[model samples]
Target: MPNSDYSARHLSVLEGLDAVRKRPGMYIGSTDSRGLMHCLWEIIDNSVDEALAGHGNQIDIVLHADTSVEVSDRARGIPVDIEPKTGLSGVEVVFTKLHAGGKFGSGSYAASGGLHGVGASVVNALSQRLDVQVDRDGKTYAMSFRRGEPGVFDDATGISPSNPFKPFEDASVLREVGKVAKGVSGTRVRYWSDPQIFIKDAVFASEELFSRARQTAFLVPGLAIGIEDRRGQEIAKHDFKYDGGIAEFVEYLAKDAALTATWKLSGSGDFNETVPVLDESGNMVSREVSRKCDVDIAVRWGTGYDTEVKSFVNIIATPKGGTHIAGFEQSVLKVLRSQVEANARKLKAGNDKVEKEDALAGLTAVVTVRLAEPQFEGQTKEILGTPAVKNIVANVVSKALLEKFNSPKRDDKSQAALLLEKVVAEMKSRISARTHKETQRRKNALESSSLPTKLVDCRTQETAGSELFIVEGDSALGTAKLARDSEFQALLPIRGKILNVQKASVSDMLSNTECASIIQVLGAGSGRSFDLDVARYGKVILMSDADVDGAHIRTLLLTLFFRYMRPLVEAGRVFAAVPPLHRVEVINAGSKANEVIYTYSQAELEELLSKLAKAGKKYKEPIQRYKGLGEMDADQLAETTMDRSRRTLRRVRVEDAAAAEAMFELLMGNDVAPRRDFIIDSADGFERERIDA
Candidate 1:
């Protein structure tokens, strides 16, 4: 029923760049903006590789209005001489032939970012038009290509991709455009992305371009990158040069207060790799070569608990990381754990072991490795697959960090001591939180309960629909008990303002009666050991009176939640109950019952009064102003603040934790100088009538 015979006639082979054009994803990774950017990166990385080899120090890039990108560098230009085998110029071979370049163990480069020799060729094939000019040997040579084919463009008016073009039928030409001064050598490349290959909406991202340029400058210290943009009405330009390398990079990435100075670690190791070599007879042979891997790192610890670690391979960014990052983290944890254990008595760490998270917390680091022809996981090069690199990098990091820890310098000794104490403190906090969680979990059994007697808990055991209302005082708690639905609403009453946990130590916070009771009633651990899945309630609502003292009490409670139970806030499960501040009773005509209206804000009350006057409706002269929840009856409180369908609730959210932390520190922290300054600065915006004297 079908033709089963398969023969040689059916076999087809794609030659030159045809295979690349057919399966572009295999080379560039996609046909979207990302792939377009990858092509640009390929060309830029080649120039950067030259700089990495100490051949250049300046590179310039331009983004033209015509959607074309140009890169120029002051480096040894691509050779313009003829090749014996192909009879083509080195520039032509580099751009037209796949898997052909000087980077494949030609002794031209000791280490480079380019591997497989396909970067330049793939970019050339994907570009609609490419122009190359090289200054070498006191002469300037030029070449043009249309989609990987060497040709000439008849651009008598202007340089454009749509200009008339002619491809060489028999032989290609590398024209000697002009002559240059002696000792001048460089290369300039400009290309237009092919619309036929990429999506119509795809365009270059300026931010990504600038970020990559800045990163490269950091990786290769002393290399300057100048960028100019003519895509907008106003021209923009930037120059990036870093002398401190990754140390400056680490400083730029850190956002919180500093706990330690930036430290640098540098070392190298050697490993043997089996690779193919070109024999003298022009044949390929397998041979083993000893390769050296150099690892350089910069690291610092901050006062906040956020980790930022960037890894690179031969100046190329490996954002997803690989063996190098694995090795770095492993070594850091090992060294810190050992240090913490050795000095347990001085730090008061009582048999509590350190964890990987503890070692990484508050750390900002940059890890980079340089090796020749390292194995990459894919064409995108997001990961490294060299197994030996893991151990090599691990050994380097371990030895260098140990040396720093044990350095004889006074500054080094002090910093090491502080860092160890911080890690031990974190370990102890984790252990304490875990102990609280286990103790509370055991008390959750119905037969034997240790929950606070004052907490009026809901009857339901399910957590999804359960709610916890933290009331202001005993008076409000009595009314809430009668207004709440006993099946799902739980109440926990506090006598007055709780301790500000932001300024208090962990032990002080855990030992306070009110703080301990709140933590115990929630049935979840505090801080790093908190398990969100085991939380007793679905929502936490703070209900307090509408006054200055009420606001202060709420702030103190929020400080506790933010410091110890941050996950609940991040998940948007925290809320503030909104209670009406005024009640207006409108007198109806002819014995009809009066209509009562409630307002939450002064503006809303004024608007309602204006509308009622315009309608010629009469209301009671003195409206009732609620000073506290105690003044409201049970039914009124239920309708205004407890009934889910009728009450107004404001959800509390933390969009920027750093900004929130700063504000909390300014207001509640022990440093009174900054708080006094803030209050003095804000005095102009304060009002007189808002305060209840």
Candidate 2:
């Protein structure tokens, strides 16, 4: 059934920017507003890199009416001279070639965020049109591109040989745009995202951009970042410049909280590391390499329960955290434990050490590390993977913390004493709570067999292969019970909506019968006593109706898990089962020519109908749309949702705990204003046709 002529001739290679356009998600994450913001980030990162290199101090960003963005920075402008390697102007090479910037292996920047050198080129590849202007050597040079291809100005006037750059085919080289004032130098970039590459009517959110600009300003001291929105009728402008850097950031985050103590610490050091080097004999030899690094940390402890610890590697936020955060946390915990023991001895208090959670509670800290040649985990650089930086940060933080704690000013009435007292109180409370939970857990274990009467337990004893489906209603549960394989699949039915754990305390949540049943079914103890080893099911799948009500129920259940059994979510054991929403019956002329087709979405239904039409097949009118899982028969439900071989399941993961926690609080918390605002913001791009009710 295949062609025998399939050979080397069929192999295809994408050249230049074509590869980027083909797989844009690989470069910028996705073809949505987020990716569009990423394009802006790439350009802004270049400007920030300039600032980090001690060349730029001012950056201006503008959003145009046409949904385009322009970023200008008073940095050393991009070189205009011809690059010897490519025989092209520096500006042209940087925009057209991948991995062709000064950051890679160049001494121009000792440390930078855009280390892969693909930022500019990737942005160019995804943009519909881009214009670049450089102010260098008392002259302004400009270049333009369309769809990642270089283009010439329509009016090629004032073309003179006095320009330093040479011209390309039909393209006037870096055409001199204007004469800059003496000693003024910088680069300005303007780009418009291609409509075809992004979601429909994609537009940048001004608030998001402003927040990012403010963050950059705080991260880089003395750098002024300004934003102007010309897209709206009234031009909005904001400027951010911070002299205290991360210390100011900490103060800002803790402004509303009742802070007990606040302090900043910083240190720099160089360590010798072994590396392989090539010798004259073409053999590898071991040599010592010196790596320099700087660590700056600011902390503010308050009376609130929230903990905000933001970590960065050379100004790039590591929200997921990595070795650097691990080092910082370990060092803080070590110092706090030592100090608590000392304080307890001095006061003749009970001999008990503070737990990690107690030390981190009510804490707001910013950990920043600047180093040469940092190793990041991924392209987006949400994590730092360098092993040596961890040890270096730990050492620096330990010394600094010890010095601050042992200082003569740390008397009983000092801020240091106040913080230590708070930590010790928290530790005592946590220990008491843990003891109570352990006692309760033992009692609950003995009564675990008294599972909710509604739960239909599976026959299998193999926990690793067993799955528990938390169905929405009794109607759906009835169908699931008839369809599920009794050997490995169990079903638990809940009525209506359960309590929203985001707004409920642990004691309040454990009192709810629905929440209690689900927790007991998953043998993992709830809250602080939770242990992943005791989990009864390999997959705790949330199966609900494909409607708005079902979505609310699912959210309530997720909140319960996220707050009580978070380790289950963190271990990737949670899943969501997607049930088909539409079923189409294809019919032919004969008596035995009826066929059934199931579609998950409206788009898929349309595509299926179109394919049937192309094949000259006829289908009946009035396609059946499933409003709830109860609408599907047991056999159909089994084939579409529960079958291990054909069903679709989405594994839930917590990519950013801080963001996830914030969203959960906003959506499920008692606050209604934030939820209303969130709904309004999300409804901007939502489609009404997708709603079932």
Model 1: per-residue Cα lDDT over 1-693, one tens digit each: 011221222112115676788789998899998998889888888899899988889999999999999999989999999988878899988898887776787656677785357988888888889999999999999999877777899999899998997776657789999999998999999999989899999898898999999999999999999999999999999999999899999988775556789999889999999999889888999999999999999999866555889999989899999999999999999999999889888988877789997888779999999988888999888998888899998998899889989999999999999788778766776776777677665233455677899999888878898899999999999999999999899999998999887666556687898898888878788866678877888999999998889889988998888877889999998899988889899999998999989888777888999999999999997998999988898988999999989998888899999788778878987768999999999989998656741
Clashing pairs in 1: none
Please report how far candidate 2 places residue 101 from its true position, in Å. Answer: 2.1
**lDDT minimum window of 10 residues, candidate 2:** 5-14
lDDT of 2: 0.80
* Alpha-carbon deviation at 106 in model 2, angstroms: 3.5
TM-score list, all predictions: 0.85, 0.61
After TM-score superposition, the amount by which residue 481's alpha carbon in candidate 2 deviates from its true location, in angstroms, is: 38
Please provide, for model 2 over 175-272, each residue's C-alpha lDDT reduced to its tens digit, 9 standing for 90 to 100.
89899899999999988788779999567977788877887888999999999899888999999999989988987775223445567778877877
* Stretches > 4 Å off in candidate 2: 1-14, 153-172, 255-260, 272-288, 346-351, 410-413, 440-693
Clashes (backbone N, CA, C under 3 Å), per candidate, total 0, 0
